[model samples]
Each structure stands twice: as C-alpha cells, then as structure tokens.
Target: MNPELKLVAARQGGVFSRAQAMAVGYTPEQIRERLTGGRWERIRHGQYAERADLSALDAWEQHIVRHRRAVHAAMNSMRPGSAVVSHHSALVLQGIPVWQVDLAEVQLTRTSGRGEVKAGVRHHQGRLSPADTTRVDGLTTTTIARAVVESAARTSFEAAVVSADAALRRPEVSAEDFRRLLAVTECWPGSPAIRSVLAFAVPLAESAGESRLRVLMRNEGLPPPVLQAAFNDAAGFVGRVDFYFPDHNTVVEFDGLKKYADGSREALIREKLREDRLRALGLEVVRVTWADLLQPARTATHIRQAFDRARRTRLAG
Candidate 1:
C-alpha cells in the first residue's frame, strides 16, 4: 500500500474503500491479489483492511473491534453526513461497556426515510437534533445519553441497564439528559422500558458485572442493596463493598476477573483478609461471580441464605 492509502485506512479504523485503493494508485487486480494472498481482509462489500491490522483479540474484544471496523466501513460507503452512528454502535465507539446488545449490525440514524437493514448496517429513521448528536473519534454519533436511550429501547432490560449505568458514569451524561431524550422518544416502541432503565441506572456501578448483579437482584425480588458501600472496622476503613444489604447485614461482592487480574497468591490472601475483616464487623459476606450470574435462581438462594445466617447470628448475640 502507498502512503496515501495507508493514511486513509488509518483514519478509518484500519479500513479502506475499494475506491480509495484505486485513488491511491492501486489497480483492481492488485487489490484482488492482496485479498487472495491473505494480506487484505474484506470488512464488507467494497471495504477492506489489512489482516495484520486485525490483531488477535478475545471473543468480546474481537466482536467490538469487528463492529467498529464495520461501522467505519459503513460510514465510508455512505455519502458524508447522511447518517450518524447511533444505538449500540455509538456506545461501542464511545468506549462504553454494553452487555448482551447486538453488534452484528452497525446502527445508524438518519433525519429522514424509513429504517432499513442492508449490507451489515441498520439505518434508523429518527429526528436527531444538534444536542442529540456529537462527534466521537471523528465519527458523528449520537450523544451518550441519546445512544443509551436508543439502545435501551431496542434491547433487553438487563442489557439496557448495563449500558445506561456505564453511560451515567460519564461526566457529560446525567439523569436529566436521559429524561430529556426520554421525553423526545416517549411514544416510540419500548419507551416505557427505556424509562425503567433510566430510573434504574446509577453512576456508582463500577463494572458491567456489578451492573448485571444489580439487575439480577431486582429481577429476583431481592431488596435493593446500597452500591459501593463503605465498611469500617476498628482497624480503619475495612473496604468498600460492591453491594450492601444494610438490613440483612450482608455484603455482596461481584468477583469478576478484573479484581483478580494478577491471579496472584498475595492478591487472593488480601481479598481473604478483607472478607475476614468484614465478617469481624458482623457482616455476612456473599461473593457473586460471573458464573453465578448465569444462574440467577441459585445466586439469589445463596444470597438469601447469607441473609438468614446474618439475621440468626444477630439474634443469637
């Protein structure tokens, strides 16, 4: 590839259009040769990227990366400013964590025309005011608040809450912003569910696991737990917990890999010590892992058992 095409591909998330290759002095045969030789990978019709640019990534990360490249490719294929990236695609572009949302199609919103899906892109027909859209990484996309609401309207409640919680953590996003967007999209399909998501979303959720656990607890009819609750003992601040059931005197921690990324003995020992301190403070510690979340009923049972034990211990005292 020439310097010109290299620059173009770099600007578009390592993707380039067929026309761009030609413009940069590559013949169609040359492009075909590169594709056949496994040097260039086709992102979509008329869009290609160097295979080397698509590095090995974990399943989730790779999905996001492929979706991002597809988004850029779709944008490149369309006329400039014809559509803005919206919905889950916008959330991905803004680096917001989304759970269980479809990334198979790049989502775009246009000011007019009926919505349609074609060539791995979904175009949504909606009114996007200036306030509802912004530029993320040089691509026009719906604002975080707008994106969250749009996504919530189309996905499961659990998925919506996860994205909404992450979006709320952004300084530029607020509950008011979501409410305003909600008012605009009030009559749309699934608006009520979006409303519920906004009401449930909190900026305090520090990770997707914590957010999902909160949703599961609600769905299972468990009492709402205080998020990121701090516990102190005679030694000082014991630690901040993921979820705390004040009435039950129990602490629920979402044990995701992020907390134990190092997987070191010392890290495990420190966590054990932290749980011991919480126990010393008369709090029942219940740990929830990603696997536990997959079985909501079992997880809820475990938490309830902890609650019962804490209550019994208190009564015994």
Candidate 2:
C-alpha cells in the first residue's frame, strides 16, 4: 500500500472508505481493481479494510473490530454529536463487559433533533443531558451509567445484572447513578425489570459469572446468603468467601469453572487449604459451577441439604 493509504487506514482503524482511497491518489477504477483482485475487503457499503487473514484474532475480537469499523462507517457521514452511540454500543465503547447482548447493529441516539435513521444503524430518541453523555476515543456515547441502564432495560435480568455489576465497578458510576438511570427510564417498557435488577445489583461481585450465580441462586428460592462474608478462627482470619450462610454454618463458593483450568499448582494448593480451614470450622462447603448454575433448582436443593447437614454436624460436634 502507498504511504497515504497506509496513513488513512491507520487513522480509520484498519478500515477506510472509497473516498479515502480516492483522496490517497487511487482512482475509482483502481479501487475496483483492488476489490476484484482481493487486495481489500468490504466490511460495509463504501467501507473497506485491507484484505488480511484475521485467523490470528479470536472471533469475538474480530467481531469487535468489524463493529468499530461499521460504527465508523456510520459516523463518517454523520453530523458531530447529532448521532451519539447509545445502548449496547455505548457499553462496548466504555469497555464494559457484555454477555447475551445484540451486536448486530450500531445503535445511535439523537442528541438534538430526531436522528436520521440510517441503513445499518438503529437510532433512538435519546434526549440526554451533557452529564449523561461521554466522549470516548473521539466518539460520542451515552455515559456508562446511562448505557448500563439502557441496556439493562432491554435485556434479561441476569444479563443486565452482569452489566450493572461490571458498571458499578467503575469509579465514575455509582449506586446513585443507577437510581438516576432507573428514574429517567421509569416509563420504559422494561423499567420494572431493570429496577429489580438494580435493586439486586451489588458492586462486590467480582465477575459476571459470580453475578449470574447470585441471580440464579435467588431466582431458585435459596435463602439469600451474605456476600463475601469473612471467616475467622482462634488462629486468625480464614478468608472471605463468595457467599456465607451464617445461620446454617455453610459457605457457597461460586466458581466459573475457568478458575480450575488456569490457577497454577500453588494457587490450587492454597485454595484447597482455605477450603480445609473452612471445613475444619464445621462450615459445610457447597460448590457451585457453571453446570450447577444451569440447573438452579437442583443447586438450591443441594444447598438446602448442605445447610441441614452443617447444622446437624455442628450440633453433633
């Protein structure tokens, strides 16, 4: 590629438009020849990226890069601030984690007048205050709090909590921010559901998988356990556990099942020692994994049984 074309691609995130190619001294005919010869690939109408194997990148990464290009493709022709990225699109821009979100279209919100409905963009009438919008990477987007609520209002409860918990981890967003988001979206279609998740949301959840397990356990009728409960014995503090049932002397460990695969030998040994300490205290440990989470009822049943066993074991001892 020529110097100018390379510069243009670099500025445009490895993707450029036909107009960019032309400005870089390539004629329309030359662009067509490049496309025909497989030297470039069309990501969207008028949006092209150099033809290179993307097998080195994972599918999710490739998806994000293409989404960014498509978003740029949509924004390249849009008026500044007139089309602000919102909803799930804003979540992505804010670096928030997402699961079970629709990534098929780049969503935009009108900052002023009704935004034009473009072919590849989903436009919403989001008359947001300056406080509710943020600029990320030269792109306008709804604030992280607003984006989290907007997305939560449209997704399943578990998925929304995952997002909400993740958003709460950020210093910019807070519980009050969540309340404000809920208040503003009060009349929205999914407001009640979103509010419920917000009410249940906690910042202490360290992972989406943990948030999800909490939701599952609640929905299945298990008594809500205190989160990150600290344990102590005569020696010293045992450790903080994911969930603790003080009433029944039980501890529920939420494992994503990924930890078992990655934690080194020393980490595994330390974890086992921690469990042994908890068990020595006569606290029955109930482990919940991804598979257990899928069958919430069964998991709840096992937990109840553990609760009973712990109570009986403590009495016997």
Each prediction's TM-score versus the true structure: 0.97, 0.87
Off by over 4 Å in 1: 53-56
- Candidate 1 clashes between residue pairs 3 or more apart in a chain or in different chains: none
For 61-80, candidate 1 gives per-residue lDDT tens digits of 98999899999999989888
> Which number leads on lDDT?
1
Reference-based lDDT, each prediction = 0.90, 0.82
In TM-score terms, candidate 2 sits at 0.87
Error of 1 at 149 (Å): 0.5
Indicate the worst ten consecutive residues by lDDT in candidate 2: 72-81
Q: Write the per-residue lDDT of candidate 2 for residues 65-157, one digit (tens) a residue.
A: 667777766766567657888888888877887778767688888766665556878888866877798887677889989988888877889
